[model samples]
Target: MKYSIIISFLLLTVCLTAFGQEKQSRKSKNPNSAAAEKGLIKVSVMYPFAEGKTFNMEYYETKHMPMVAGFLGSNLVKYTIEKGLASGIPNQPLPYMAVGTFYVKSLDEYQAAIAPNRDAIRADFANYTNVAPVILVSEVVR
Candidate 1:
C-alpha cells in the first residue's frame, strides 16, 4: 500500500512539472515586453492581371507605390511596390504584375486603415490595363 501511494505521488509530480514548463515556454515566446524592441508586421498584396495589358512600368514604379504609402501613418516601418514577370505553369506564360506591400507597426493598425474603404481601395486599381489583382495579408511572426 505504501509503495502504491508513492508511485501515485510521483506521477502527480511529473504531470505538474510538464504543465509548468509548457506555460513558461509560451510566455517567453510571446512576451509583452514594453521595453524590448517591438516587431513589425508585413503584409504582401499580390496582383494578377489579365493578359495583353498595357502597363506602363514607369507609372507603377514612380506613382502607384508612392500613392499607397501616403495613406499609411508615420508608424510605417517600410513600404514597397514591386513588379516582375510571373513564373508561369508548364506550357503557360504568366503576365506582368504589380505587388504592393504595407509594413506597419501592428496588425490592428492595418485593419483600421483598410476596413472602412475597401471598395475605394479596390477602385484605386481600376486604371490598370486589362488586369485583376489579389491581396494577401500576413503577420510578420518571428
Candidate 2:
C-alpha cells in the first residue's frame, strides 16, 4: 500500500514535469552547450503525507537545504524542493507532502561526499519534519 502510493505520486509528478520540459528541450540548438545532458544522477528525498504529519517548509528551505548544498559542494549540480498540492483522486490527500531532489554529475562522487555528512543531515530532519524521509536515486536517462 505504501509503495504504491509513492509510485503513483512519482508517476504523476514526472508526467507533469516532462510535458513542459519536452517543449523547452526542443528549442535548445547547441549540442555541446553547458546545459547539454551529461547523464546526471538524481537523488531525491521524499516525505510521505499522513493525516497528522507536520512539515516546516520555512526551515527546510531557508536552512536545511542550504546547509546540505554546502556540504555537497561542487558535486551538487542543482537542487529543487517541491510541495504537494493535489492528488489524482479528488479530495484525497497527496502521497507525499514534500520532495527534495539534488542532481550530481556522478553518483560515486555524490556518495563519497555525502558519506561523511550523512549523520549531520539525518540529525537535522527533526528541525523541520516529523515524518521520516524516503530516498530514491536514479540516473537521468534523458
Candidate 3:
C-alpha cells in the first residue's frame, strides 16, 4: 500500500512539472515573433553554368559580395553563398554553378536597399560569371 502511494505521488509530481513547463513555453514569446509577424523575405540567386560559360569565384568573393554587403548594410540580416559540387546522381554535373541566398527582415527593406544600388550590382555581374542568374524572392513561413 505504501509503495503504491509513493509511486502515485511521484507520477503526479512529474505530470505537474511537465504541465508547468508546457504552460511556460506556450506563454513565452518567440524571439523572432516580430520578424515572423512582419514576414521574413529571402532572395535567392542561382547561376547555372553551361558550355563556354565562366564563373569568376575570386572576383565574386573578393569584390562583388563585399560591395553587396556594403550596399545592404544593416538591412541584410544574413546571407550565404553555396558552390555547387555535384548532382544527386553519380557522375552527373551540377545544374548550378553557384547559389546565393540573402535573408532580410522584409521585402520592403530589400527593395529599398536594392533600388538604390541595382545598377551597380547589375554591372558587377560582368566581373563574375557569364551565365545569367535566375533570381527568386520568397517569404519564410517557417
Per-candidate TM equals 0.57, 0.75, 0.69
Candidate 1 lDDT tens digits, 1-142: 8987787678667867987998788778877632232466777766665656655657655766666666676757778777766443222455446677877887787677767757765676655544665666675555
Task: Evaluate all candidate structures by whole-model CA lDDT and list the values in order.
Answer: 0.65, 0.86, 0.80
Model 3, 26-134: lDDT tens per residue? 6575655544534668888999868788998888878888788777778787788888886644445778988888878767877888898999999989988888999
lDDT of 3 at 116: 87
Error in Å for residue 135 of model 1: 1.1
Q: Judging by TM-score, tell me the better candidate of 2 and 3.
A: 2
RMSD over all Cα atoms, model 1: 15.5
Candidate 2's C-alpha runs over 4 A off are 1-35
Of models 1 and 2, which has the larger lDDT?
2
Error of 1 at 45 (Å): 1.8
The Cα error of candidate 2 at residue 29, in Å, is: 11
Name the better of 1 and 2 by TM-score: 2
User: Rank by lDDT, descending?
Assistant: 2, 3, 1
Give the best candidate by TM-score: 2
